[model samples]
Target: MFKEMKLLKPSWITALLVIVLSLLSIQNYRVLPAKEDIIFAAIHWHGPVLLTQTLLLCLIAWQVVSFRKIRFLVAIRGKDEVIQKNLLKLMTMEVIGYFILFDGSYLLTGHPIFSKGPVIIGILMLVLRMVLVWFLGLLLITTYTAPYPGLILLGVLVVNLFYHYVIEMNFLLIQYSQTYDPLWKAFNLNR
Candidate 1:
């Protein structure tokens, strides 16, 4: 029965999980006034993480999917000549998994980033992040066939830098003050 059913290689899931785990990581610390109590920070969790590093994660996902071995590469070996025909399916699955796992963790932990957000905004935040990552993965993979891949990579780097400094889009994961959060009441949905 196991053989009859399709199973993905463990490595693909491993690589996808690594990205999710990294994003969901908590940054714990204590301020001078709260020295005795460790605080699980929302902004501190991923605030300092550079956008370039996020792009690197996308690149890593691309590289992992490009692996040739049985463990890293499977489920795309169709009779058709196009080896990457299932690339969209694979990327969509990875993004959905990334959203569910990370957001689910946020929901359970009551992280201020997730807990203090309105239901609609919270859902939108997850969706936007996943869409950007999915697009980046596809962009990175497209470069493989380009003649001057380095130039394209450099251009991508510039855009990421612009987004990091100018646009300043950080997955809407902000740390709202406990007492002043207008959306705090919406946290019931999280629980």
Candidate 2:
């Protein structure tokens, strides 16, 4: 019913991409948004709350979804732990770079993304977008590497449907941002 997989053995190119992107974070966003601004800054994509939730979910989903849906135990069944750890390191680096670039860009340039229509509905819609895009990424990556990736990709979608973490995290982000948005920034920080 199941076979061992070493799906996350990241290639040198992937590592290079992670390294390059992390280097970019060293630019623009040097530190947290000064002091009190950190609170208001929490709503933006770079905010700690949102990023933490997303990271935790991604980690959890990687194992939980794979185990339940794909029927394979990653990091446990074999020599997968080392590969998983390396992939995690690179992923973490990339995420940090993402935060720096987006937040710093906002601070230096202006708001990069926003809700197009209303507030709550638009936020949920954005959540849907994230969920779909993430699923697509999972599909594409799995398809490229593993010959029997359809079931794994389907597992990702099933997991998303069941846990709905994408919506939950985005909702929390919006609420936190709304709660902490400074008068000067207003809705600008709710990216």
Candidate 3:
């Protein structure tokens, strides 16, 4: 079973996976109700949250598939510890990036789905966005030799940046720039 797997093989399939996942995220975002204010935007956090979670799940699947390939390679090519270590590190970073994305989205959207409190949500989200970007960087580096993978990573970066700057940041800025009295009164946050 492992013998059939190949590292950097089926590059188009991986690229397609990335595209499908991103489109799902964008679809979730697009479905939200339009509102002037971020706090009262009538947006349900579940869609985006679930979508992001799905992306993470896909990444895990990729990791497993890649591991199978690595195992096959190890068996035939004399067990390169460095490749294994690097793969593990990349997977770890991807997991960490997912957590950051979740926390950040939660905070930026004003805890729409879960009420985990506001203290660390923003900070975590900022870190998560950075981590997500970093994930793309790693993807680009790892898949640079493969045209499809590199192109897919580039596409993901473009989409992510578009969403962050055009949509997410707009809402965040609105949330931050407004007077606190109305927001505090609306959300019942004592401050």
Candidate 4:
């Protein structure tokens, strides 16, 4: 089972995750606050958030990279065919997981960011992503080469950044009134 898994080298995977985790930790933090609550805030919450996002990103990235490894081009590539089929199956599971995550998080948190409407939208988007995988996988099958895998990877990274910093931050601000928030109530989303 371990050999059949075809995992990437542990070091390479760690390095990739570190890059993303570091970027996530650094973006849109200091400037977002007025006076630096840097010490207490970083000490209290940053580490946990960083760890959680790192793990989540790592899991998502693993799915992506693993799927890309399946070579789609060879007419007789049993390996590619099997891997692609497995990826499709895994993606279905992932979609269901996302829906559950969205629903559960929204219900428990009572945060606008995780509200039922957004959760439903997020679930729909997950389904859309799976559809994209099917179409993209078909393209790769016909071409036998993922000519622009980097493009898709970069796109996903950007989307993650927007979700984490922009969307999540807005939702969080609306839910919690904090001294750490910026001076302009106009800029703040607190309701």
Top TM-score: which candidate number? 1
What's the candidate order when arranged by decreasing lDDT? Answer: 3, 1, 4, 2
Please provide, for model 4 over 1-191, each residue's C-alpha lDDT reduced to its tens digit, 9 standing for 90 to 100: 32534542234554454445444544434343443332223222444234534354345445556544334442355566665565555444443443344334333432333222244544444344335434443333322245665565555546645544564455443333343256555466666
Instruction: Give lDDT for model 4.
Output: 0.43
Candidate 2: minimum summed lDDT over ten consecutive residues — where?
Answer: 36-45
Which candidate, 1 or 2, has the higher lDDT?
1
Off by over 4 Å in 2: 1-78, 110-191
Tens digits of lDDT, candidate 1, 48-134: 234324544454445533433332223344422233434445545655665555455554553344344455654554455456666
What is candidate 2's lDDT per residue for 1-191, written digit by digit as tens?
A: 23323334445654455444433433334553443232233334343333333443344335333533442443255644444454454444444444454345545634323322235654454445444434434443443236565576566555644443444344544453454224525666555
lDDT of each: 0.44, 0.42, 0.46, 0.43
Screening candidate 1 with a backbone cut-off below 3 angstroms (N, C-alpha, C), the clashing residue pairs are: none
lDDT of 4 at 78: 54
What's the CA error at residue 88 for candidate 3, in Å?
6.8
What ranges in model 4 sit over 4 Å off? 1-57, 67-75, 78-82, 105-151, 163-184, 187-191
* Candidate 1 Cα errors over 4 Å, as ranges: 1-81, 112-117, 169-191
Q: Return the clash pairs for model 2, or none.
A: none
Best-first order by TM-score? 1, 3, 4, 2
Candidate 3, which ten residues in sequence have the lowest lDDT sum?
35-44
Cα RMSDs, all models: 9.5, 11.5, 12.5, 9.9
lDDT of 4 at 161: 50
Candidate 1 TM-score, C-alpha based? 0.52
